[model samples]
Target: MAGEVPAAAAAASATLLALELAWSPSTLTDADIEVLVVQGLLLEKAISGWRSYFGEASPSEDWTATVVFRSFYEKGFGLPSGAFFWGLLHYYGLEATHLKPNSITQIATFIHLCKGFLGIAPHFNLWRALYHLRAYPSKGTPDVVGGAAFSLHRGGKYPEAIFKDSNKRWAEEWFVVANPTPGLLPRTGLPPVVNARWEEKPTEEEMVEVQVLLAELQKHKAEKLTGATVALSFAKWLTQPI
Candidate 1:
C-alpha cells in the first residue's frame, strides 16, 4: 500500500509539471524578435535574384542552378541548410541569443517567432518540430463555456523520446561544423556525438553576400521593409567586414 501511494504521488507530480510547462509563456524578448526580423530580411534579399535566374521558367530543369533554386524554395526562407541558418545567426552576432538546436521548446519558440513576427511560410524544420513534439491543432468546442477559437496540444512523451533514441541522427541534424562550406557535407546520416556545438561561422563568400545585403539595406534605408526596424543599423555595424 505504501508503494502504491508513493507511485501515485509521483505520477501526480509529473502531471502537474507537464501542465506548468505547457501553460508557460514564450521566453523570446523584444531583442530576439528584432534579430529574427533582420535575419529573415537579409536572407530574403540574398536569394532575391534566384527566381529570375533559376526559377520554374529556367530553360533546363536538369541544370544545377535550377535544382539549387528548387531546393531552397522547398526548404523555406532562412533555411537553405542548417549550416546556412547557423551561419546567418553567427554573422548577425546572434550566436549567444539564438535558440539551442537540441532544445524542443526553443525550436518551437523559434517557429512561432518566424510565423508571428516574420509572417513567412513554415519550413521542414517546423514540420519536424511538430512531429517530434507530437503536436496537433485543436479546434475548441463551439458555444461552450470557456471555449476558445483554437489551440495546440503538444504531445508530452515525444520530446523526451527524441533524446533517448539510439540513433541520435535527428538531433545531429540540428547542428553542423563551425566553419562549413555549402555542398561539402551531406545533410543527413552524420555520426552521432555526445556533445555538439551549435555555433557556425560564415564562409568568405557568405560574408561577402552579407556585406552586399547590408549595403543594399543602407541604400534603401528610406524605404520600409516588412518586419524590419532601426535595429538593423546595429546589425550592419556588427557585421561590417574587417
Candidate 2:
C-alpha cells in the first residue's frame, strides 16, 4: 500500500506538470518547490502539537491539523508537483515524510514564475488599467486633470480628425521630450521652471495624495472580481459603449 501510494502521486504530479506546460510555459520555479517541501515538513509538526495534548493518539475531532495539511497540499499542487505526497498522506490519514525534491518540477516551476514575474503571462489588471485610463480620462478623476478624452466609438477612425487644427501643435525641434505622462501629448510651449523645494525627495503631502489616489482606485476595483477571464472581459469592455 505504501509503495502504491508514492507511485500514484508521482503519476498525478507528472500529469499536472504536463498540463501546466502545455497551457503556459511559465508557472513554477525550483526555489519555490523547495520551499513547499520545507513547508510540508513543518505542516507535519502541527500534528505533534495536538498529540502532546491528548497523549500518543491525536483526537479524531481535532480539525486544526487537517486544515494545515490542506494548506500544504494546496501549496504543493500550486507549484505543479500535484502535491502527490500530500495527497497520499491525506488518503491514508497519516503524517509521512515529504517526497524528495525532483529537478523536473523545480525547473518547470521556475520557468513559470519567471514568465509571470516578467509579465509574459497574460496580466489582465495591467491591461485593464491602461484601457480604462485611455478610454475615460475625465470620468472618475480629479477636476484639475486635463488630457484627450476623445470618443473612440467610431470604428476604424482616428479619435482626432486628421485635418482638425484647432489644438496648438508643437514642433519636435523646439524641445526634447523626457519622461512625460503616458498617453498625453507634450505641451506646445517651453516647459515652465519652478523654484527648487527644500527637500530632494517628494514631500509628505505628495505621498498622502498618492495614497489617496491609490485608495480610490482600489475602491473602484473592489466591485470587480479578479478571477474573471481576462480575454473575455476585455472583449466585452472593448465593445461596450464608453
What does candidate 1 score on TM?
Answer: 0.20
Q: In candidate 2, which residue ranges exceed 4 Å CA deviation?
A: 1-203, 227-232, 239-242
- Each prediction's TM-score versus the true structure: 0.20, 0.15
Q: What is residue 166's positional error in candidate 1, in angstroms?
A: 44
- Candidate 1: worst 10 consecutive residues by lDDT? 142-151
Model 1 Cα shift for residue 179 (angstroms): 35
For each candidate, what is the lDDT? 0.29, 0.26
| Superposition error at 95 for model 2 (Å) | 54
Q: What are the per-residue Cα lDDT tens digits for candidate 2 across 34-125? A: 34346542223332231222111111222222111222232122211223323322332222111111211222222232233332432222
Best by TM-score: 1
Model 1, span 100-139: residue lDDT tens: 2223223333343334443443333232322322111222
Lowest lDDT sum, 10 consecutive residues, model 2, at 170-179
* lDDT assessment of candidate 2: 0.26
How much is 110 displaced in model 1, in angstroms?
14
Candidate 1, pairs of clashing residues: none
